[model samples]
Target chain A: MKERIKVALAQISCKQGDKAENIRKIEDNVIKAKQQGAELIIFPEFSLTGYTVRDCVYELAETIPGHSTTVLEKLAKKTGTYIVFGMPELSEKTQATIYNAAVLVGPDGFVGKYRKMYLPTHSVFEEKRYFRPGCKAGVFDTKLGKIGLIICYDIFFPEVSRLTRLKGAQLIVCISASPATRRTFFETLTAARAIENTAFLAYVNLVGIEDGLQFWGGSRLIAPNGKVLVKAKYDEEDLVIGEINYADIRPIEAFVPTLKDLRPELFDELREAAERL
Target chain B: MKLKPSVLDLKWTEVETKIRRFIKDYVEKSEAKGIVLGLSGGIDSCTVASLAALAIGGDKTLGLLLPEQETFTTKDVEHAELAAEKFGFKTEMIDITPTLKAFYDSTPIFKTTDKLCKGNIKARTRMIYVYYYANRLGMLVCGASDKSETMIGYFTKWGDVAADISPIMDLYKTQVRKLAQHIGLPKEIVTKQASPALWPGQLAEEELGIKYETLDLILYGLERFMKTEEIAQQLGAKKELINKIKLRWVSMEHKRRMPLTTKMQYRTVGADFRLPRTLH
Candidate 1:
């Protein structure tokens, strides 16, 4: 028998700059995901205060292990479910700096968080104005497996995923608030990441319209073999539960040989040469 | 050369699904009882009202037909009422001839020949009624302004363009026609000539000096930041025509945004001070 654990993708809409209401909605879905027997529940980018916060970052940004983490800690302790969600993190090293962060918490307490490495400044995204890009990727250990975290535009950068996988993360949860225009791009990139890394992926997205941007939510769980396990409806709030087995990817990783075939030694030289450009 | 279907085509089922969800989400978030829209019996409003009916149900969506004496026609009334019945929404017709007459009687320089000023009065008058119904019923007003008109400043400010939310505002005029057909609306309604009906026999294509098909393609090219010459080459159109459209598109920027003010404050409301309306 395989050791399987269910994962829930909570594809819900966030009220922009409203942390209290957004958390209330998140809490509701956390209970529902737990009721459906999901051991790990995930929410989309800026799930705490909503994306497109603009200058409200001054007011909405929360310190890690502060109000949001403490509340999530109580929920995680009660449900016995590990949760991953996004929030605007006010930096501890420097209070003036803020980073878009993907946070993780379990039954024990807040485990860790990965600040998003890429702050997309182009087109509809003005994240660069509000966030300072994170210096490193994060992979955290838990009872289920080593889980990794990535933000919306971070999925576009393959280096982040490779670094996380190289650090021994078997499952990567990409929390996004991607809009309608970028839907096709995210869909293609997600499956590609899972197949290349030979790792399980859970993509959770925000739904609903904020101003003129209609977030087309098509949240899904992808297998190591690039197969879709479950998908949520677009432009609507949905909680989709999918099962994952940590041991299932071991053989595929061995057969595919992606991790084994990587040549970091040669890549270091290539990076040094390309740096001149 | 005509633009390819691959360039402008849409999977209307997906479009319909997304739009219905937008309507539902907007109404839900605003905590409004239902949707209210001005029904001109043209393709845009008919299509919008149909989508609203599908989004929240016919009973909740109210379509108001505000026709005046100069532009009144039985065929349009039939079309408007038929659309209401077919699309499963209720309709109430009000003769705005008296309102226009009242303004015409009271105001100075209310020349009957000055169609532009009188026409604007009619458009603004229709909005007053629309907003009144919305206020009375606690329903959000859904504007039927399409993107093509919106981009080129074809809509009347604070009148036809005013609404709590405009679901079809993202779609171009030609795209809205395709959407109307896809949703299985009546051919008569879908193919009807669009008019603002502020004046008698006033067609949008005639006033704009460009057909919707060409206008949509030109707008599409311009929106992509294609050079006027490049847009002309692709569409097989004159560069002069393309430039004319481009100039209008640029000059009409004020209509698309809030009125500009001098940046005296640290953060200006319409300029650097940016925040989503939901937060307020």
Candidate 2:
């Protein structure tokens, strides 16, 4: 594994439900990031379509390893750059069901995807109405490093990132379409998640407004020690690049050992109590 | 004045940044050339003008100062011109007296004593001119209905309230005042008494029967779902007054929403069906 890899976060506003336009922009970002010597380029949640896609869910939903991934895979092959992006996945098992999924594509082809586990259905978010819950947290291995993937709301749950870290992932990528209202929560939690899991956390958030909702594009990358290495501009389109020193993970983990002090066995009683409730 | 609750004090810098982004993004999304808003020389409109100029350059922003004869004042025009000068947006002086006179002439039912009707006509006339510029120049109409007036249905519907987008409507009048000052609006504009200037000697506070300083807090309490009694107790105001404010807030609900439609179909537009953000 490489000791260091540069990652680029494409914090761009999306044209809602315009897949072709969005894909064109995504490909442009990938090329730019690749030219900047970034091995991996990250985009925000629903980068293929804007987040306020209530009625267009059925029309915009595509199959995994489907057209978007296929197009991205070819672009990956051409540029030799790995890309992670968010798209609505139509469930093959349950034809009518859809999932908010994060897709990973590289020089090899489609690697894997993580469906969002937490479907936030409160406030401005009605994800439960549109998407079925994702099955589990997942980690995909690439030439860069062992990488874990999560969506916007899943960052709230510590177990998601902890499980990925315990599964031997060094970096966690969270692609979000979070708005201005919940910015402080995401910012504080991203750093906390990295500190506890002792893994690099790169958060890429959507920019621009849709349907009266404004998104604050404060994409940031946090090191294992919860240090903010780089941050994007607020409320505007900005491409921010940061280096992921894989070598620092071990020393930070060895010194802090936050992940090593885990005691999941004790949570069985609390889990049982949750079932009782 | 007693110290207001801390909740009303927003971080102006953050608020301005977010609102600026919203204006700039909405302008881009609509693919419009610039923004066109009726500048009444009030705190609300001046606040919007300052922010719009900051969001998109002042060269792109257009402020129309529509002065009718009955309520027209040199001071209003001067204040508006000051705003245009401070923020680099261009200003146009449009005398709407001719349009109002035509409305009265065309309508046989027009009454000399009906100041309310005449005021509404003036407001609607200004909208036509503002929208005319918007259509001709490919710009979007930005409305300046602040939350205090909006919650109590103080605006003339389909008149001054009509807009392609409302940038400062979410803010209360007091909040708008603070924001206006923070955005570098002159003290004359920021401290000016709230008025629609539909007729001479007309004031919004006089018509609403309450001060914005108190009204914003009542609306804030109601927004939090606080009981009228609780709000009265907390704010040290009368229960009846709080109840009255709450009634105005709820009774004006129709003003804040689209006209109701009976739902017989599986889904109805403006009820369950809504346009996608991209389409808008």
DockQ of each: 0.61, 0.45
List model 2 lDDT by residue over A169-272, tens digit each: 89999999998889899999999999998999999999888888888889999999999999999888999899999989889989998877877887898789
Tell me the TM-score of each prediction against the true structure.
0.93, 0.92
Classify candidate 2 by CAPRI docking class. acceptable
Clashes of each: 0, 0
* lDDT of candidates 1 onward, in order: 0.89, 0.89
* Per-residue alpha-carbon lDDT of candidate 2 for residues B180-239, written as tens digits (9 for 90 to 100): 989899999988999988889999889888888889998988877788888888889999
Error of 1 at A8 (Å): 2.4
Give lDDT tens digits, candidate 1, residues B10-44. Answer: 88998998889888877888889999999988888
Calculate each model's fnat, 2 decimals. Answer: 0.64, 0.46
Q: For model 2, what is the C-alpha lDDT against the true structure?
A: 0.89
* Residue B258 shift from truth in candidate 1, angstroms: 0.8
